[model samples]
Target: MRSLRKFLYWLNIVGMIAYLIVCGYFQMTGKPLYPGQVGLMFQVASGLVLVSIPLIIEKWAHVALPDILVVLYELFILMAILLGTGMQAYSIPNWDKFEHLFSAGMLAGSGFMIYAARTPADKQDQIDPFLIALFGAAFGVLLGVCWEFYEFTGDSLFGMNMQRYMAAGKPLIGHPVLYDTMGDLLSDFIGSAGMSLYAFFKIRRDHSWLNTFKLHRIK
Candidate 1:
């Protein structure tokens, strides 16, 4: 696990270095510093911050997030920045939607970790499966909404058009923005729902599932 963690750390470092080089080349060539250039920088910073989350939570809140989850989360963020948005993969049909789905699943997993971290092992059985699913899905949806809000803010603050809120210098106040935003939300919900349902059944069938998730049950 330590070796794998170190590998991921270095992988991110290399990816970030490559990203800066590419963006710098574009900037020097008089290309606009939008989309991939801006997004790559943001993703690199965000990935660094996310890499510290597990350790920070462990120290401050006494929470131990699963190592698998930490790796998965970092990989997804890197993928989005490095391949999806950073590579202009939105030109491919439904690629953005796939990313939204993936992100929501990651959020659902985080929710499961949080719930597991807070619940006592002995009392875990008393919690309903439906409640587990509901909590995880709800948490994922909340995060999805918050992400949309961030996109919205980005659109307002900069002309990045992160939310598909404009075309040809005119704001899209109608079906375009509505369709794009709602579609993302729906994808997020569906992805999260699937993860929550699986977690619910796993816990229902055996308490041993907790061991697989790598969270320490609170006393």
Candidate 2:
């Protein structure tokens, strides 16, 4: 089991590296960064990093990280190709409802990971799992906001060029910096908050049920 886990861990590392290399190639070649997509290689790389953390910290043996990477990759690629030439809305072939769904899932996963990190395994009373999860989700969302800010900066003041590429089919170059970024941030907050409340309430209810169902024999 140890050997297999080690192998899988290394495999994930290699796969993430390879993914970055491909993205770098795309950047260097000046090919449409996803031709019909919004984010660049960096967005995918960020998600890969999130998936990698649990594997490295917990030594997880499962294929979760790689699987997630694959899913995100395929989704982004498909979104890019079928949607349009850039992050613009008109280019999308459909309503793109999946985009919001995927974002929520990402936030939820991030929240769960955070809770895992904060909660202790040895004792049930060590910390409130719900609180941990909530904070984790918040942190994850904050990180996302920071990333979006970085993108904004790259496209605005700097010559990142990625912004233009990312905005491919959009009618305009610059978006309302504060408005759009805040709106996205709000969405992330909602996702995290919802997951936190759900987890907290669920844990409380389960504990109540378990306590009520405990068996006691009088001798």
Query: Whole-model Cα lDDT per candidate?
Result: 0.75, 0.48
RMSD of each: 4.1, 10.4
In terms of lDDT, model 1 sits at 0.75
Number of residue pairs clashing in candidate 1, backbone atoms closer than 3 angstroms, sequence gap of 3 or more or interchain: 0
What does candidate 2 score on TM?
0.46
Candidate 2 residue lDDT tens string, 1-219: 345444554554565566557656776767745552225445545545654464453354432332332344334333432232232443443323344334544555555544444444444345565655566467657766775778778877865643234444453444543444555566667755665566567656553321211222223
Worst lDDT window (10 residues) for model 2? Answer: 209-218
- List the pairs of residues colliding in candidate 2: 36-80, 36-84, 37-80
Best by lDDT: 1
Best by TM-score: 1
Give TM-scores for every candidate, taking all chains together and pairing residue i with residue i. 0.74, 0.46
Collision pairs in model 1: none
Report the lDDT tens digits of candidate 1 across residue range 1-219.
Answer: 556755775677677667777787787797945654665667655666665566677677775667656666666655666666566666787777887777888788788777877887788788887898899899999999999999989877876787777778788775676877898899899989988888888888986685556565334
